[model samples]
Target: MAAVLEPLPQPDPPGAKTSASTDASHASGSGLKPIKRLISDSRIERIVPESNAATHLQYCSQFARDFIRADYNFCAAKVTVARGGKIRALDAAFRESGEWLGKALTWIEQHPTRSFPLEHEVIELKITHPLAGRLVRCLTQYDRIFVRSMEVLLAGKIQSHERETLLLNAGKRLKHIVQVCIPDNDAYLTDGTRKTK
Candidate 1:
């Protein structure tokens, strides 16, 4: 005879630390308002300003490098996936005096023919953390394209040329990503009106 599978019973909730009446009194005493956590889905959110995108790319790259050095799986994966494959390892970024922006800026200024190598280190690292691999893959294409586009835009800007085209292209790219990643009802107005879905 074959045995049938059975579901396990749910456990009872832990006893309350405070009574409902006490909660209300506590809330009233100091005008304590319940805080709703702002759960933003970055995956869907469009890059606002080009500057914002740059900031994110730079910081995410820096974090990835530090995380790799720390040997922390969680942080490393978050950083690597967040960047996609557009960036090099964090160790490379901190070559001189352990400075991130300094090294990056210097590299940019010097305009090295080969700034950084694109190694699939993250993919191997992802073996220990599959989610990190996914994140890395997502960010790589976007980051690379965004960075290249930004460079062209900056060159135009520095040359005192009209940046309308550059701005438009960046906006378009950001919009495309945002549309894919963000749901319609994510944003809201100050007056508590939810954005149209």
Candidate 2:
């Protein structure tokens, strides 16, 4: 699914003490909407056989990769547009990006493998899946990047050079993640036998 790009409530004005009502409004704003599931149980059952743990892992990884890609693209577009002397707009985009990043991390943490039945049988599959682990770490890094960026933006001390640098770093990271997630890439995949490196 595409990342939600609804308008988020503006942050409190500079030098203004944030009030309780403002905080409540922000909580109920579009920036903090409920997270959508990355993969549904019914979809998993339809696409992956119960006995095929490897395929399930592959499906989960692909879904996560797609979601992150879409989110990154959305954030990039917002940042690009906001670079045209729109600081408040940029701040809103960063806040929205942070929300999506949190959702992605949560989804990764609650990977389907962790909830699969026959724990003993799938324990190794859950622990040993390189793509799943790598995706989690990558998303964590992204979360950190966005949090730091938002801090700078919210503090009203972000310089143009600093914003450019952050965007460059984020783009580089996104490229690395996309490379790692390529389904046919031998670096992250194996022969059709479900062998993991």
Top-scoring candidate (TM-score): 2
- Candidate 2 residues lying further than 4 Å off, grouped into runs, are 1-33, 39-128, 183-197
Model 1, poorest ten-residue lDDT window?
50-59
Model 1 residue 1 lDDT score? 10
In candidate 1, position 100 carries an lDDT of 29
Residue 155 CA displacement from its true place in model 2, Å: 3.6
lDDT of 2 by residue, 1-197 (tens): 22232344577788988777766664443233222322232322233222222211211222234444344333222222222223232333344445555554453343232122211100111112323343434544564444444445455556657755654655455554333223332322122222256
CA lDDT for candidate 2: 0.37
- The estimated TM-scores of all candidates read 0.22, 0.34
After TM-score superposition, the amount by which residue 52's alpha carbon in candidate 1 deviates from its true location, in angstroms, is 35
* Model 1's TM-score against the true structure: 0.22
State the C-alpha lDDT per candidate.
Answer: 0.31, 0.37
Name the lDDT value of residue 84 in candidate 2.
23
- The local lDDT score (0 to 100) that residue 66 gets in candidate 2 is 46
Which segments of model 1 are wrong by more than 4 Å?
Answer: 1-72, 75-124, 157-197
lDDT score of residue 56 within candidate 1:
19
